[model samples]
Target: MATYGDLRWGVHLMKRILFLMSDTGGGHRSAAEAISDALKIRYGEANMQIELVDVFRACHWPLNKMPEFYPWIVNKSARAWGWGYRLANMRPIYSLNKRMIYYGNRQRLHNIIQNHAADVVISVHSVITPPMMYAYQSLSQRPPFITVVTDLVSTPRYWYDPRVDFTFLPTQKAYERGLRRGLEPERMRVVGLPVHPRFSALRERATVRAEHGWDDGLPVVMMVAGMDGMGRLYHTARAIDAQNLNCRLAIITGKNAALKARLEAQTWNQPTDVYGFVRDMADKMTAADMLVTKAGPATISEAFIAGLPVILSDRIPGQEDGNVTHVVENGAGVYAPTPAQVAETVAAWLADDGAQLRQRKANARRLANPSAVWQVADAIWEYAHAAYIPAPKKSSRSARYRILKPEATPQR
Candidate 1:
């Protein structure tokens, strides 16, 4: 048995971790970075080497363009996206998709694993998980592999693979979904979605407001759609502004320069601040009394940590559908799809000196797992330490290039 002291001393041995993800959305990369940061925090940076690879970007032609095409796919028609999502979740279609992915990208994926030579591999994206696992199965000496489901509730079927050494679920709902999809109970853990550690270290609301030059006297309502500013943010802002509410507005038009410019060009009824993509979201959330945004898992998790009640203005179809229910049902927030509904929800929360808003804030805080990042880091570290083994001596060039046998291929 490896003693605790022995493991501590082994810290000098520099463990390598490979995080496999895609830029399909910001959440996957953000989750990878949060976990990577957590690992560095737990075991000093020198003790570990972490690399994030956009697996889809490294794949063959059409597959490689997935990251680039994702936004268009969602933006073009959410109903179409939802249809495809549901279609792919069918048992036969899912199996066929896995086979096609394995056959198409096995060699490239195998090359990725060989080149990276990691002690542990983690997948944060649903689309790449199955194919990556298939490639890992071909290796004679495979390390531990983990799947951290970034979706809060309605996780896609592609996210679950029984062969994975471990699966980290963001919520109990997600874990149940995995169980229904055949993931062993013991192999899956319901750890909350990992957000930046900064969210956990929120400062006093008034202090943060003071630092940001926001008025402490007025209630702050922060509105954000996403990094891409995908939803009806401008209209929603207009609706809220038209309400003539006493609260101040902090609108974050993230990476949407046009939207920011447009919002800035306008005259408002209230003390409103318009900002572009900001790095200090944690600070902004801390300063705000409430958050109005879409149902993105990462944003929701961050809001939970900040204890800010969310007023969901929009959500992507399929995967994000359940997130709305999770928030509203948990009493952390309400799902108001239309701009008028969002305005109404906001106005209602602001009533009675924000009595309802405070209750929602308490609920959000109760659902938060502020230490989730650290917990996930600790689990991954344990897996890495346990799975670490000395690399075998180099084989002949011909032997190294040998393909996986049919008998060794992974099954559905």
Candidate 2:
């Protein structure tokens, strides 16, 4: 009911902004938390309110309710989200999904909007976008529905309607892709990725390492790769020990207790620390000499935002190619194609020419738009209030990515 015109008087401490995130990837939750953190630091507790609802849990949707129903399909497919990442970025696949998902998620998004009474709603995942867009139809007054692309590349399916107030992108390519998808250039903001501001500030590496009880002078190699908690741990550990590299390694085995136990059993002569899951990634990043990670858009972007050099171990396919390009082109990181090659590259990176480090930092800084939250939050507020909310804009930046329609998939 109230539009930007109504907000001319400005908002007070009571105004509320709600964020919607998924449990699927650490990136989505991390992005939402980072924004919330920034808002709190800027406005303090009373001035801002944030609730991140997992849509699956918020509503007993069948597809979401029984994770076991399609266990093999679901888990395998999710792990294959990288293919989706690529498919979502490439061709007509990207464009069509935008419209399809937009319609499918309608009811759920409506319920979420109505229940939360959010002045503005932010979606960190694309699956929620379509539903959120349609949910607007059921409201007496819909809130501004904001979609933040949590990957290094822009998602075509996520940009179907220009009605969205703003689409936040991590890379220039993504911003351009959004424009090609029929978004107005003005509506596209090249705010790299939303990372905790703590990462933006330079932390004293020695202090962070000391607090973690790491050796005083060794190079700290932090692997940001996903853990299987199975055989992979020993292989990676053995590789490290055999290399006889002079570095302290820290491996984050996220949600993998088995891998943790297995790794603990190994008496690695090389100094190392293994963590299950860590909230203080920024600190760990600061303490590390160079990061070894998987090429997931969010992690890559976070590492980029932190200004730490990277060596991406596993490159998830599809859009991750673009994600990898962004980092490598900028000189902030290197992609190690072979598992064994990792140690050698680490050696080279430790002894890199001066300009390379400077360039990497420059590229990382260029990608980071640290003030993204204020801009995004403000845009959502403005759009949600308008009596006439626009339809989602087609992204123009996505023209190069338009793929053949699903109808054209060749029949075997």
Candidate 3:
């Protein structure tokens, strides 16, 4: 059993961070990876150790299968998914499930936290927070726990837990939502969503387009269906092509092999490019004029970072609905739920030498927070070092703080 007092005063120890997340959506894992990347940039690999644990996978049978159910509900059982979301939105329902899941996987989760010996624990997914908190009860020396909400504005009530040391919110709406959920102002920060640091780098549109062998002069409309490619991608692309607009199409059919084959086989009316899974999304996004995609929080945030406007084609009923409103209300993009509307909006944006498109791009840039990853990482470091470690005590003789000698500190 150790506490902050166990550490020798004035000694800077290597910080070990454990990030709790699940694969329910790629955004949760992406948020964790973004913070990891920022930590690498800020502290270098030698000084920081980061471990990402899929909390759902670490849990018991039915509970562990929760992540797998996300795609099935969003794609196959949309109505049922909406119903479930509404049911779970109630605090009582969420608490019941949270308690069940926590008890069901208590031992395994406790072992994870104890084994990791983490200096700081960050929960990126809402479902993991309760379980992680439950595990913390078993430890005598508990680390600082942080919750970084992956959802944009429409976060579920289950996401907020007063036990957490701090909560990082992505939007002002999310911050306001936290307040309503009884979060103290001191316990939350309105830091924007975390994207890869590469998105923060300046890139020339023409240069990126040329590097990818895309047409530099023509407007490029990029459509992405997230990692699952679970949207009306084919119909939207078809509708856009039917309009005979003077724009090129680039489709990212993520892990959807059938969709990829079908799209590649068809003869498009405009110059088009098809990619299966792209690692360099930042470069691709930078080259594009506008993005046509589902209202995923990560995609929207990435688009903002790239200074590209969006055309939202679909949104999962409960959680993703706010993403659409955020984009449209902020003047960063338009919400076109159907293929026809998508085509019409694209046509209008491309009309009159892309006057409206340029305006949206400016707005997107205004909303972009590419440096958010660094901000979050720095905040984590500050909190962990300041509150989780013992401060130097002053000596009466000199009235100066004591400093530890190099040889006096022991390494783990």
**Global lDDT scores for all candidate models:** 0.85, 0.63, 0.83
lDDT of 2 by residue, 329-368 (tens): 7777887755577777766655554455556656665666
Error of 3 at 209 (Å): 1.2
How many pairs of residues collide in each model?
A: 0, 39, 0
Candidate that would win on lDDT: 1
Candidate 1, TM-score vs. the true structure?
A: 0.91
- Whole-model lDDT for model 3 versus the true structure? 0.83
State residue 160's C-alpha deviation in candidate 2, in Å.
5.0
Ordered list by TM-score, greatest first: 1, 3, 2
- Residue 5 local lDDT, model 1: 19
Model 1, position 165, has a per-residue lDDT of 85
How close to the true structure is residue 11 of candidate 2, measured as C-alpha lDDT? 40
**Lowest-lDDT window of 10 residues in candidate 3?**
397-406
Q: Give the residue spans of candidate 3 off by over 4 A.
A: 1-12, 386-412
The order by descending lDDT is 1, 3, 2
Q: Cα lDDT for residue 125, model 2?
A: 74
Question: 1 or 2: which has the higher lDDT?
Answer: 1
Off by over 4 Å in 2: 1-13, 57-62, 65-107, 138-140, 226-234, 351-368, 373-412
Residue 349's C-alpha lDDT in candidate 2? 58
Q: Clashing residue pairs, candidate 1?
A: none
